[model samples]
Every structure is written in structure tokens, then in C-alpha cells.
Target chain A: MLLEVSAEKRFGNFLLDAEFALDCKRCGIFGPSGSGKSTLVHMLAGLLKPDRGKISIAGTPVFDAARGINIPPEKRRVGLVFQHSHLFPNMSVQANLYYGWRRTRKSDRKIGPGALTTALNLDHLLKRDVNSLSGGERRRVAVGRTLLACPRLILLDEPLTGLDAELKSQIMPYLKKVFTEFDVPMLFISHSLQEMRLMTDEVLIPENGCCRKRMSTEELARSSMTSVPRSYVNLLTLRRPQAHNDIWIYSWGDEKLRLIEPGEPGDNLFELGASDITLFKRHPEATSARNILPCKVVEIFGSGGRVGVELEGGGGRLVSQIVHESVRELDIQNGSELFAVIKASAFRKIC
Target chain B: MLLSPQDMQAVWLSIKVATTATLVTAPFGFGIAYFFSFARMPGKYLLECLVNLPLVLPPVVVGYLLLLFFGQSGFAGPLLKFFDLRIIFTLTGAVIASAVVGFPLLVRAIRIGMDNIDIHYIQAARTLGAGRLDTLLTIILPLSGRAILAGMTLMFARSLGEFGATIILAGNIPGVTQTIPLAIYDYANTPDGDRMAMSLCLVSIALSFAVLLASEALARSFRKGSADAP
Candidate 1:
């Protein structure tokens, strides 16, 4: 879906003037709180009218102030999942899930209720009241409810904002599964870099009520390394875990790495901080760390006092964060070979 | 049990008038409450003031205005004449008076209910492909059911004890427009009629107590229904 928007809206002291055009299926609007991320979502969904501008979805003009055209939200076919699951209090889980499906035109109903229930794992809770569900279950049902509408584009406005860490992890996989299976275009909005990396490929950064930048999700994450407290977070997709006595062994591409934490079978995502990987000029013997690999320095580029060493080894790539002084002492440069040491316990499973 | 045939007629007429007034006012009450709670039209505060004027003003003053409006030379006089309807000194006039007098209470209750509902629910329904009227009927209306019931109960109780308005508009006819309060008023005015007046007062209390109890029971059931799985 191609979403084109050029709109301006003012709420007293705050004015949101956004102009952008995106054609990606998975796009994100990333910004801090009160930076007008939600305002843009509301405009796209037709819940909040833009003061003066034009908005078109897939070449259809949904809103054009100059042309005197403004479609209502129900006719726009732009579904939204709010932060809190605002499921109808009077409806059962089944009723809430099908509320949109029942209203969608037969020709437009691409996602069926049965398939949605199975995908969202909501079949067991169909007979339960909405208030009885847990936070993660409510979010799953909310996503299911929106998907059943078969919208042209779905907007998720900080859908996991208030959830705890464990609940957030539980809901992310379902979100990924739905977008993949249904092939529906979505605009994911959130402030967390981790969520953006996991859910979207490209991101639009909104600041001070305007979208100032548009870049790849990886570029955005890397740029934040200098400012974010965590330095840099390396996302690793590991699979085929085997129990190795006291530890778990996982395969990364063609290389096997031992981890202290055990993971379930199949593909698992883990976050290893760039600061956690210690670089050595030569292979160090008798170290307590379990994982050590000889890697070639592919690139060395960063700002501020910290430098990022891009490593290519273990049949994959990893970035190690180190101080500038260390870079000089180790004489690190492009195409230089080094040993990267990491403790097995440093790997944190995200999902 | 302690009254004449005319007293019995008055007792039955009170129930009929109160029931009719409450039923007729319910839909309009809900509509006005919705408008107040959600609509963003200009001059809304003015409309609100008009709707709530009867609540603060004296009921006798409300009846007097209705009397003139439906009188021969009043604003609605030509309209009533066109429809060949008589509103003054009739049971219909009693119902109109009761409805107008109790309207503010009913609207207040429903508006509170609607206001308490989260705005996101309405937005969610709209994005989920439900139109304006569809959302109102399916979401807003059902969510505020208890509030509507409470409003109706308040209106019904108010209509049962509606004295000043009913007396002025429908008059104190013994077997026609006289309700329980009007009957009690008559007995209190006559010589050696204290027993009849006291008995009618007791009946009024019992009727009001019954309405309150019924509303409580209904509200409890509504709560349980929403909590249980379908």
C-alpha cells in the first residue's frame, strides 16, 4: 500500500505538520511521547481530520481539503489498534473479534474469522468476556479484531506501550505472524527502538510535530548508539538449540555458539549489547567467557568517545563497542583480524 | 382499600400517566444525553441550558409555560389545532407536563453514563467499520444501559409525585386527570379528610420504594450479564 499524506493540524499550542509518502508494507512512525506520532495516526485513520491538506491511500483520495473530499473513518478501510484494547465492554471475545468482520463487505473480507481466531489463538477465549482476558490476550484479540476488518492499511498506535516486558515479548510474535500471514500493510508506531527493529524495515522519525527524517530501521538504530544509554544492541536470530550438558548450544548460520540460558526449539531472537563483546588482539587462553571467535574487522565507524567495530565471523556479523583509546591501543582498522570474546550469560533472549 | 371509586380512579390514573410519561421521554432523553456527551456543535451550551431549565426552575412555572404554549393563543396553539388535538386540561396534558418536568433528571443520568465511557471505544468502533448510527446503537447505547435505566427510574418516580405541573395543566378532576398526589391534595383540603390524605401518602411512598428496588435488581442483573460469558 502506498500512503501519501501532507497535512497540518493544530491542537492549541501543538501543531503537527507532516508530509511524507511511503510504499513499504511494514513502516514505522518512531518518536517520543507528545511528538505527534499519534496525531498522524489519527489523521491517517480519519478519526482526526487534518486542518488543510490531502491524503491518499493507494491513489484513492481519502481526504482532500481543496477538493472538498473527506471520507468518514468507517469508509476509509484504515483499521487501528490502540494502546489499550478498547474491546466493547458489552461484547464477548467472539463478538468483539467478529464486530468488524461482520461489517466488512463480502468482497473485501479477505481474512476470514476462523483463520483469524486460529492465528491469534483466540478460539479458546471466544466464549469469555473481554474484561476477563489478560493484557497479552487482550492485545492479541485487539490485533485480531482489526485484521478481521480486512483494511487496506492497519495503524497500530503504541499497541504495546503499557505492557510489561514479559507481556510485550509474548505479543510481538503474534504481531509478526499476523502481518506475515495476512500480507496486510501496516504502519507501526512506537517509541522503542527494539520494537521498531523487530516490526518494521523503514522508519519515519517525528520530532517537534514534524517528520524530520526517513531512513532504514537499521540506520536509525545504529544512529542512536551514541545517545542511547545501552550504547548499541545487537539483535541475533539463532535457531536449532541443543542441550549441551549444563549449557544450551545454538546455531548461528553455520557456526555453533554456547549460551547459558536455554531457549525453546525453533528460531529465537536474542539481544547482545555491543559493549558486552570484548575484543582481543590475539586469541586469549584460559578465559572464563565461553564464546570466542577470530573475526575480521569489516568496518570501523562511529561518533563520540565510543567506536563501533563491525566484525564478520561465525558465518554472521556482529558489532562490538569499545572506547576510542582502546581502538588506538589495539590499532583497529578496516580489514584487521581480531578475537572477539563474549560471556555466554550476556545473551538476553528477547522473544 | 380505604378509598372511594373516584380515589381508585385517581390511583390508576397516576400509574398510567407516570408510565406513559417515562416511556415517551426515554428515547428523547437518551438522544439529548448523547448529544451533550459527544456532539461538538456550536452553541451546544445554549441548548444544554434550555434542556436543563426545567430542572432548576419551579415545576409550577414549567406547567404555566406549557399551559400557555398549548393554549388557544400560544406558540403550539395552531399546531395542536391543525392536528385537532387538545392538550390543555386532559390526560395528554398531564403526560406532557410530567415528561417536561422529569426530562432533566433522566438526561442528567444518561449523560453521566455516556461521559464515563472511554472515548477510545468509540474510535475503535469507527475504525472497525461501524458507521455513526451503528456505533451508537451497538456500542454507546448498550454500554450506557444501566444509566438509561437509572434515568428512567428517576423520571418515573418524579412523574408519580408530579403535583404542581399536573394540577395546572391537567387540573384536579376527580375521575379524569387527578393522580395520587392530586387526590391527596384534595383530601387534605376537605373537612375531616385527614385519613384519606394519610392513606394516599403511604401508597405514594410504597410505589416509589418499589421503583427503586426494581431498578436496583435490574442494574445488578445487567452487571452480571456483562461479567458472564455469552
Candidate 2:
């Protein structure tokens, strides 16, 4: 395994106990706020010592509480891109990126600055002071700096939390490129399912303070509703439109779906949260919903008093959750034909 | 040409003593300040109080304490004799007395600078495989330049005017240990020495103004450098 951790820590009322082992080149830890996601990453990076248990990276035991072996953070060879992009205020962009480059051994250097600068589109930014860069620019530099360190593994903490839509779109492509080009394992932490899908194939979902499950992105898309809010349901593939600048148009069978924003690279799936969608027994006129797809009910699943009606329409599939009373009133059943009503803003694009 | 050869020697001695004291106190001050800023240990408050004792104590008492430690019959007598180094009533003693009096000011400035540094920078440095020393030399030291410079200047200024401590430990020696302040006191006590004292006073004012101006310029440049960073 490239990374192995079974650690427990307690902070007042909150307890963090996470255990996972992964050899995948790209893996993600997905959870909501206060899920102990950051705490888990910190432990793996050796910033915080686990009260008990062991953590190993690339076959080297970096921390073994029982054996009294704990390696310091500097020697752990795990790089982290902080949420705030903590670039050194005193150095230029070139200096900040090279700060780690100069420290790594020549034999360990898998990539050089010249190529990285070109790939990250950082040629014009190297000589500028870190303070002058925009939010998106700073994030790019932070990633470059961490990657140049020649670490065996990398950890990125919520890299897209605060960026505007424009900045997020600008930086996401570069980040995806880095994820694929780097030959080391990476542990990405995020609350956004779209970001997780874009970056990793496998994911560990943390709830409360423990990693409750580990699964692939495909499984997560198909069965993500267990831990997520009721609004989010199945993930469906969407074909990119030929030439749409602001809105992405995906045509299913004969139904056309229009999304507000562009999707990340390799993004073929769109999340239709059940709450954002409604079902109609007959085609209604004068509705604000931009997407009205004719679908056939394929399956019916229920939880509590809510009913999840899976529909296959326009060469795509999705689920719509409605109250049991509505299902009874509308007589929703398997093989029943219905129209799935989706707001243009409700479609969340994911890779 | 308003000053005599003896007056010139006094001015020169003051500069030498202040410069030496500032240089000597800098490394110790930085280390102590860095420790106080970052390290967590038992009785840290007590250690901080001990380091800052010179700031609140009387200068004469500080000199007396130095004398007791470095005197011929004091606790450090053996060590001093082993090195064949004389500190009591010598130029070196004056330098020591000035450094002792100015130590706290230096540390306070440095500690404030160190305190303002974000822990994230240090964490980032470590994750990038930069060790403690490496981070200190590259990140902390460069970023804390203004504070270090301010501390050194404050120490130098304090050392220039150190009088009570110098009188007790180094004594009033004309061409050796007598700095500007000690020389001024001597001239004030002697008859027909008012003119020389006035000239020295003007010279002292001019020197202090130059130091302050230089410090201001340095601080401004640091600000500009950060503002223009790209």
C-alpha cells in the first residue's frame, strides 16, 4: 500500500478515529464540514500526532504509537497544499515554487520547473511577488510548489472551497492535468462531490469522525444518497453540447437538458438532486423549469415515507424522490410514463 | 573641529561599544525570542520573566550583577582565568555592561516579529522537506527582517546611552572605557568643560538622528519590496 493509517484522536467532544489503506494513485476523502476530514489529512501529513495506532507511507512506518516510532513532518515526504495557499509573503513566485525544489534531492526529482511552469501556465507569474497574485493564481502556485518538493505522496485540502465560478473553471483544468501527470499517490479532501469525481477514482466517506466507507466514484454516484442530503440522488451522464459558452446542453433521447455552468474536464455526469426535480403525469404548460424530459419509470425504491422513482429517459437515467402520498395520489408505478421536471440551476455537473 | 582629540576618542569609544554590544546581543536575542515564540515547555513564564528582568531593573543593579558574575572573586572567576580574559574595568566590560542593559529591548522586538509569523508558513515549509533550521534561515529570518533590524537599532541606541551600568563595571577610563555619556558626566563635573560637553551633546544628537533615519529608510524599503512582489 502507498498509505496506511489507523489512528484515533480526541478533541473535547469530538473524537476522530480513521482507518484506511490505499495503493491507488489518486484517492479522495469526501465528507461535509466537521467530518474530521482536515484532521485526518493532518495526521497523515504528520502535522498532528495520533494518540494511538500506526501510520505508514510507501512501506515506511512514519508513525507507530505502540513501537514508539514517530518520524517528523519534514522527513515524511508527504506534501500538502493548504486551503489558504500559504505562500511565503517575503518571496517571489519563482522563489516560493523553488523553495522546495532546491531542498529535494536531484535523484528524487521526477519533474522539473521548466516543464511544470509551462503546464501550469505559470511562466508569466514566476517573477511576481506572491501577494500580488489573484486567488486562482495563488492556488496554482501552491500546487506547483507542493509538487516540486518530490514527495512520495501529496495531500490537497479543499482546494476549491472559496473560489468564484470563473476562477474555479480556470484552475480546475490545470489541477486535473497535475493529478494525471504526477506519478505519486495523492489523498484529496473535499466536500464537493464534483471535485472528488474530477480528481480521484476511489473515495473514503467520513461521517461524524470516522471513515464509514470506501468505494469507487461510480459506486458513490450510484449509491451516494445513504449519507448525503435527500436533494442529491443519482449521477447521470451528459453529452457536451457542440458550442455553448455559458450553458451546457445535454440531449437525452429526445429531451434536452440545459445546465447553468460548464463542467470540469472528463465530466460526463450531472447530478439531479431528487429534491430539485418533480414528476408530472401529463405535460404541463407555462412552467419555468428549462428541462422537461419524458421518462419511463424503471424502478421504485422507498425509504422512510419517501419514494424514489428511477426513470430512464432520452438515453439517460435518474431518480426523483417524492412523498409516498404523492406517489399514491399520482399512481406512480414501474413502467409508468412520466415527465421529469428539472430547473436549469439544479443540474450539478460532475466528472 | 569643534571637538578636541579627547572628545573625539570618547565619541569613537561610544560607537565601538554600542556596535559591539548590538552585535553580541543579536544572536542571543534572536534565539531566545524564537524559543519563546514557538516552544512549549514547563515554567516558560518564569524563563520569560528572567530574560526580561533587565528591562525593568535598575541599570546600576544590572551592572552590579554583571560584576558579581565576572569579578575576580565571583562565580565565573575560574572560567575567566582559564580564558585569560579580563572583563572588569576594561573596554570589554563596558561592552558587556551595555549589552546586558540592552538585551531585553532586543528580545522584545524580535519576539513581537516572531509572534506575527503565521504557523501555516512553517507547516508549509516542513511539508516541502525543509527542516527547522532551513525554515528559520529562509522563511522566518527573511520575513522578520524589519523586526530584527528594529531590535538591533533599539539595542544600539540603548547601548550608546548606557551610563550607570558602565560606571560600576567598566569605570571611567579616559581613552579606553569612557563613552560619550560617561565623558559628558565627567566634563559636567569638571570646571571650564562646558564647551566640550556641548559639542559632544550635539554630536550625540546628530548620531541618534542618523540611526533613526537609517532605520526608517530600511523599514520603508522592506514595505516597498513586499508591495512590489511579483
Interface DockQ per candidate: 0.57, 0.59
After the best TM-score superposition of candidate 1, give how far the Cα of residue B199 lies from its true spot, in angstroms.
1.6
In angstroms, the error of model 1 at A197 is 1.2
Q: How would the docking of model 1 be graded?
A: medium
Candidate 2 chain A TM-score vs. reference chain A: 0.76
Query: Candidate 1's residue-wise lDDT over A129-197, tens digit each?
Result: 888888899999999999999999999989999899998988888899989999999999999999999
TM-score of chain B of 2: 0.95
Reference-based lDDT, residue B74, model 2: 93
TM-score of each: 0.97, 0.87
TM-score of chain B of 1: 0.96
What residue pairs clash in candidate 1, if any at all? none
Check candidate 2 and list the clashing pairs. Answer: A127-B230, A128-B230, A129-B229, A129-B230, A252-A314, A253-A314
Q: How many steric clashes between backbone atoms does each model show?
A: 0, 6
Off by over 4 Å in 2: A12-14, A23-26, A31-33, A197-208, A211-230, A233-299, A302-306, A312-316, A325-351, B224-230
